[model samples]
Structure formats: C-alpha cells, structure tokens
Target: MPGSSILVTTDKESVARRMESLHVFRLKLLSEEMCWLILSQKAFTGRSQASREILEDIGRKIANKRQGLPLAAKTSGVLLQDKQGREEWQNVLNNVIWK
Candidate 1:
C-alpha cells in the first residue's frame, strides 16, 4: 500500500525489531500529578453534585493506583464517571486489581 501507515503500540522491543520500515516511538509513563489530572478530568466531566474536596482526595488515590499509566488512569476515570459517592470511588481504589 502506498502512502499508508500503521501504528502499533506495544511494550515489546522484539516486536519492533521484527518489523520493517517502521518508525518506533516509545511512550513514557505519566507523572503522578499528570495521572491525577487526567483521571479527575475524565471522572468529573459532567457531574456537579459531588464534593470537590472528597473527590479530589479519592481521585489522587485512584491516580496513584494507575501506576503512572495514562490508559489506566483514563479507564479508572471512565469507571468512576457514574459513581458519585465517596464509598464507590473508595471501593474502586481498593480493588484487588491495583494490588
């Protein structure tokens, strides 16, 4: 195919080595602050009834559990979108997946 491009995202170096004519770009993990920001943005996009202080506090804990991964933070944020209670967010933060 002419003028066609494919983007592959992977953590494996060997996969890139096996490919030809590829432009490989590595993505570093997000910082804790950035993770929290991303999570908060996605989680609180349309809600206003929740307490900002409590949400921010829980959001930080959830962000830390993301391990600096943007996808993780984004996914967690999306998961939290429908949850409006502190206990709900805390439950997500304490999930076994983060362990």
Candidate 2:
C-alpha cells in the first residue's frame, strides 16, 4: 500500500484528530453563491444555460435547503435534470423527506 492513497472527509474536528489524517482539508460550507456553480459542474455538466433557465428563482431556494452540502446540491441538480417547468422544481423543493 505504499503507493496507495486514501482520502476521507468529515465535518467534525474531533473525528479528524482521531483518524490522525496526515492532511486535513477544512472546507467552508459551499456558499449559496457556489451551490449553483457546483450544481452546474457536477449535476448539469453540459446543460448550463438550460439549467439556469429552468431553475431560475426556485432553484436558489432549493439549493439553499441543501444547507451548503455539495452532494445535496448536486443531487438536486441531477433530480432536476431533464425535467421541465417550475412545478417540477417546486415539487422537488416541497418534498424534503430525503427518502
């Protein structure tokens, strides 16, 4: 395992210390500003403007509910991908049970 590499992420500093992670990256919450950005890159990938057009105002509200989690934002984006209309987006926002 000399050349093998492992990376772990956590929100707790105590857990990080316990792991004795050689390198720690303390990341700030993904800003609402960047939530869309992450969604664009991770979820939408190729459909940028289309996403913006469909998402619009409601998208920001939905993205905010993710609470700065990149995975949540990306998941939202993927869930919205290929769907049309604000009602579709609104359904996603209103349904927050997280399955």
> Model 1 clash tally?
0
| CA shift of 52, model 1, Å | 2.1
All candidates' lDDT scores? 0.85, 0.77
- Model 2 agreement with the true structure over 1-99: per-residue lDDT tens digits: 799977877889888889888888888899997897776555455666876677678878878888888888888888877667778878887995853
Best model number under lDDT:
1
lDDT of 2 at 41: 58
Most accurate candidate by TM-score: 1
Candidate RMSDs in Å, in order, are 2.0, 3.1
Question: How high is the lDDT of residue 49 in model 2?
Answer: 84
